[model samples]
Target: MMWTKCLCLLWALSALCAPVNKQRQRMLLISFDGFRWDYDRDVDTPNLDQMAMDGVKAQYITPPYLTITSPTHFTLLTGLYVENHGVIHNMWFNTTTTEKKPYYQTLFVNEWWDNGSLPIWITAQRQGLKAGSLHFPGTSSSYQGEVAMVREVEPILYNYKNETAWRENSDKVMGWFRDQDLDFVSMYFGEPDGTGHRYGPDSPERQEMVKQVDRTVGYIRHLAETHGLTNSLNIIVTADHGMSNVYRNGLVEEITLSAIPGFSFRDIAFHLVDFGPSGMLLPKPGKLETVYSALKGAHPHLHVYKKEDMPEHLHFAKNDRILPIILWADPGYVINGYFPVQFHKGEHGFDNQEMDMKPFFRAAGPAFRKNLEVGPFESVNIYPLMCHILGIEPEVNDGHLNATRNMLVTSTGTRGENRSILQNTLTGIAAVAGFLAVVFVVVTSRQILKRKRKDKRSGSVQHLPEEENTKQTGF
Candidate 1:
């Protein structure tokens, strides 16, 4: 009897951790770099509009701070803030040697990425699921000697604006799922970001690019159906960060470090600037105070912070990869170094709190509630959501499963039946455990009473209490 109770207890406990779905649904996570929250508002995005009608759509989703390509994307992959995950910059740098690797080159530098945390791809693969990546950041580099089971890296100077390439990538990824039996795959499209950077977010060129993106979105879903995966695969369409135009044409003075009255680049040991709206300066041993003062009040648009004094919400200052005297510009401003060398009409990497910094989120397919428009959620929460759909235990992550819970639906479920599988499972477990406890108590009490009345004729008095049975539900 003791063993039976123990076995039942163990079984209940194990069931609590079971994955949400009995059959793992395939996941396709797609990122359209620098796709702003409102990109569809002004454009005719019928495909995206239909996606909203067919699946769950967020009003918008917030990206982590350092809102650049690599860091925020890593936040999605790892569910950790930039500082915690340690990919603080898109361009990986070594402050010691002052050797910096450009964004594309950094993709191959294992040491630049594999800092204590692991991305979802590695996590899923390790948990008996096969995973693949198509030009996603952090895909090229191996994690603790394990890379994605399959991956593709774009060539240097690859044209990000190519629509045909996106379709081909989508077809290839679907093939990987059907042919290779892969459970998870992440795809990245470097568009609208490049278009936004070159022509500004408000330019007609960017609007045209957004149309291309919409077409690509519709095309991907069509391929999913053609591949016979529409009923079984879950798709997430999101971006790392959004784009904003760099203010120029005399509306405001550009922020130039060299143009400041007392500031001099000679005082800085190693500096990262002129990249975009965010930068950091490592002052020489004795030059810290002067350097900080020169840049502090130099311009109203420029914001400078000592590493220790950075805002807690940014979650960017703690990492060793970050240099001292970090700085950023107000939206529409870029930090210029010696001269205004960069002439891109648009930029990102601003504070995440800015509306322009937030990206869009859309999810669809078998596992999601249709036509559900959810409110904003942090991008970090996406990792746990993916883990839930994959039916795998999540790694230690900052994301909360409940943050995006309203989006999921079980098989053959309606909008009202959107409660999580784990919730239903636990409810049933509690009822059963309570029943077993009551039965044990009643039986023990009956035996004791009979023993006490042994002096008289042996008689048994029994009462069985009815319980409200709790049933498990499936979606």
Candidate 2:
């Protein structure tokens, strides 16, 4: 009876002292921007290839829209489409306003902060875990909850001339990774993306670019292994969208952002000058059909959707911020203005079976079941999958929860079924937990402030926000 009593006491003490859910493991999500699963004849990503051989490789991972950087990267982290996440295109749209928007009105930090999308890092932070992004899009500004973000300076890939800059920045990210004891780290590579933009998808130059990125990835992998972090690490390698060859001669007509009556241009994304990209059209009072018909008549090759007519699968609607018409350039064509823009071996962005289909996913780590081949999941599903591994809960994200059966081992551990439920539960729990944690931090901080104020009353100097350093004694 004494032994039993002692054991019970010890168990209770252990429960009180033990870390919160130490079963949670570490995760590393890396994106090789614009990287296609079939970049090389051999898909010469030896390290990545090995990861697939050892784990799971998704062949066709569709991106949200235009496959642009910001929205696509957002989808990767949040598992929502451009329509659902609100980062519809590379630019931001204000469907709320009735005033005519200027030709170049991009949403800055303040507006982006108000977006409804909840990045996974916010979920991780609430669960009392560390999260960091090396150069993921949407990190430059603040996100809800806690996250360590290195803002993206140049959001788009201009040309191959920026290759050196990309490498330098990537190395800096590696340095950051080395310096931190992070449980989750996201490192993004923009080489393939840049090469894809410049020389087109099938360019030998693009192939070479992937090789260069492969070297960097190899170095990162070596770093993980040498530091004994690989055992607990689950590496998720993916891309925003695939590249296509665009021939400048194929364009029919050019319409500048200035040409559109109410449309405004924000980001410098090349795809913005399409049949009519992601923004709302008010149609000058009752001229809605007239305006729509004129635009449609002008660009027959373009596909347009009334916000209400958008496919249910898209999970989009005629929201205030949504552009009335979404454009898809006819296959083998770009808009007219970019006609003289030199592009080799073009790729299409329309709903064509090929261009819309992005690369696959490859995950290797203890959290994943080995030798799994998930056919093709919507880009949005990545959010739940990520939430599952991190042991963080997320809301019922835009995409459905896909089972990772291929990656699971044959243990009767109930982990397989738990993944879906776990993601749903974790999302809600993390959200609530994060809010509570922030509240706790704020209250504690306030209490500390009151104590400091009391101390100051006894003639002690207290350091406050941006106040003079009176606490220092003339040092």
Candidate 3:
């Protein structure tokens, strides 16, 4: 019971020191969903360009396999690959019941997100830091029975292309930082992805959305600066995956699984297709080999493999949630199970190795070096970098800090952040100790003065014994 009180005291102490930790440097991770690395290439983005000028920029960052939103964003949050994190797709499903939920509804499924890994929000909060998630994917779910101190989810049928709303979210998050004193935040923008899906990635609509995203970036910085966070905030802007133009109008070969002669949905117990270029199938008992044989070499654009024989580079087949048969198509084509139901001009979920599926990364703030563009790195490595910036020990993750270490300022090195944490903690402790000492001296002096006044009233005054610069405990 004594140990429990001690533990509680330590937790309270850490919470009381959050203001000091804020001075150590707060971290904000922003995700521009499906913002392709090259989207900014053709568009004139002065804000993004200025950000690159002031801080670190990467040529590109690779998302994990199954290059979709939820799984890839989960990778950013947990530093685990899609297979490891177990959020295999945007939608949650049960093969037995054939039940499924859309992306937004799936956000509330705690079991889906809390499989075995913890997002940085949970880890940060557990370590005595306050964190918030602003409409970020997986924000609605809790991990290990604990949720972020603060979080917001986008409303149903929320508009994803409103520049004004984007700025509002930016201002709101900055307010959380300044007023609520949050240590870390993960903010999300459902931009360019929606525009890219509505109009092809190369279309003018998508280009316009990129311009809006850049302006939003500038607005966020303006808020950060206005809130007096310029000296104490580290901001990382990245995305889940990139966008690609879908091949259509009958100009190119299409991959329709239902059209295959031997391939039959009747042969499969559960299947996921038409979501994008990727599809997964769990054949009925004893039908795995038959399904594999039927789908293999069925279409030149579609690549099918048994879960066990999936390529070693793609760490997607290990999880039990993954279906027995995996299928994906080349960049231009998308796989459809029953005719071409999808009509989006743009698509993702292609091979991560494909250039079109790669996302961009940019970071700025006191902790990051200026005007630096780093080489290519995987998005998985970002989790460790954020942990380093927040001075919190990261949970077991597949990411490595060395991948992004070169981007940090010399003063914000690995040791530098840890030292800052220790220094802030010691500073808090010292301030508390000094305050207690002052209280002790003041209380003691007050009692003595009261006794002296009473003695004077009685015509006798006694003095306190003077310590020779040492106390009972030898100073």
Candidate 4:
């Protein structure tokens, strides 16, 4: 009885230790570049509106520091913030080189490339899954040993050149699905955003581009479904930042950080140049109040915040990368290019609440429950969500799975509980291994019995041959 019990225990342990058959799940993430939240609600986006109605939508999505393309894009892929991931800015001004390299230029550099720590693609690949990216920022060269299809920004994306490029881009993305099973595919569209910046957000030209983008989205959906992806392919549409029209009238105030006494600025908002719009100011000892007072006097429309006073939701204070002073721009204002003279029609990278700076998120897929609005979410949360859906582990994400849990299909029941899923998976694995062990023992016993039977037959034939030898002598 003791032996039986021991054997049973061995079986259970073996079952638990059995290898699991890995599954290949696929995901498709699409960034409509500059598609604003307002466009889905206001413009003719029948397909996109249906997507929102049938999918999960997040009310607000916050960008990581500087709220620029490279940093935010890296965050989505790696699940780390700008400070942690180290992309830092859209266009990094290297003081050492004294030459500016667009973020894409650093794609091949080992420091930033492999240092991402836990990029979504690398994580997926580690698990034996496949991923592909098309024309998204920060993916131009490769990272974590994955190369994505990426293109540099061109002046031509601003106007008529945009339509041709966009069509070509969409076609290329659609072609990727042919004969290939991928775990993830990411594509970016830069026209509507580029148009919004050049032609103003509310302009007729921008509105038309919005319509064009809608058509492109419809085609993408069609291609996804026709390829039998159906709802299995998760589609996430989001933006790096929102846009606000910066008028010449708004530039009445202008002041450089150097002009202020005992205050230093590594970077300042261009719109609030005179008063230093939405910025971080490191003040010399005993000069905080003086700098704050002078800033307020110089720019009354701006809202100033101490590091401790920043919004509780931004998660800003504890990290040193965030400068001591945070600046907020008044609605419809953004800072732009270098000193003195300049009038610009477009800008982003401002405080989260600026009318033109709010980002929206909409996601739909087999993993997502139909017709759900997801959050009041930050962009940081996106990294983890991507990892979860792809079945990859994330290493450096500040965001948690709970942040966007509502979008998941199993989010409500026992499956919705992550702990339950893990527990059940382990249980199933153990059961399978135990069953296999018992079958192995049975097969081995049968083979041994068959061998013994064959040996007995041969022994009987040998004894008969000895009798035949005697008969030959008698005959």
- Once fitted onto the true fold, the runs of candidate 3 whose alpha carbons sit more than 4 angstroms away are 1-23, 413-475
lDDT of each residue in 1-475, candidate 4, tens digit only: 5446656866676565544443334577777665666766667888777787777877767776555566677777776766667665454443333444444565445555455455676666666666667666655545656654333333422443366677676666656655556667777776566777778787887788878877777777787777777745778888777777765554545434455554445332221233213445555556777766666544555566787886765445655435566665664554322353434456566665554666668787777778787557777888878777776666767888888877887633221234445677678766765766777777778889998898787876665667688999889
What is the per-residue lDDT of model 1 for residues 1-475, given as tens digits with 9 covering 90 to 100?
A: 7548756885877576554444447889999999999999889999999998999999999999999999999999999999999988888787779898899999988888998889999998887899999999999988888999989989999988888788788889989998998989999999899999999999999999999999999999999899888877889999999999887878889998999988998898899998999999999899999999988989999999999999988988888888889999999999999988888999999999999999999999888999999999999999988888886777898899899988887463321123465566677777777777787788789888986777255443331122112222221
Q: TM-score of predicted model 2? A: 0.70
For model 2, the stretches where C-alpha displacement exceeds 4 angstroms are 1-24, 93-108, 145-179, 250-282, 297-300, 337-349, 352-356, 410-475
Whole-model lDDT, candidate 2? Answer: 0.60
Per residue, candidate 3 scores C-alpha lDDT tens digits across 283-349 of 9999988889988998888899989898977789899989989999998899988888999989999
TM-score of each: 0.84, 0.70, 0.84, 0.71
**Maximum-lDDT candidate:** 3
- Which structure is stronger by lDDT: 1 or 4? 1
Error of 1 at 2 (Å): 21
lDDT of 2 by residue, 1-475 (tens): 5445545655564444433322335777877777775774544778667777777887677776645666678877887666667765555544334333221233244355347767777767766667777666666556654345433434443343355665566555545545665677777765677667667777777777777776766666676676666667677888777766554443445333345454323222222343222333444445555555555645555566666777665555634556555555555555433323434344434451454346657787777776767787677777777776665777657766544444544431223335654566566555555655666677779889998888778874444632455445444
How far in Å is the alpha carbon of 289 misplaced in model 1?
Answer: 1.6
Clashes of each: 2, 19, 0, 15
Residue 202's lDDT in candidate 1: 95
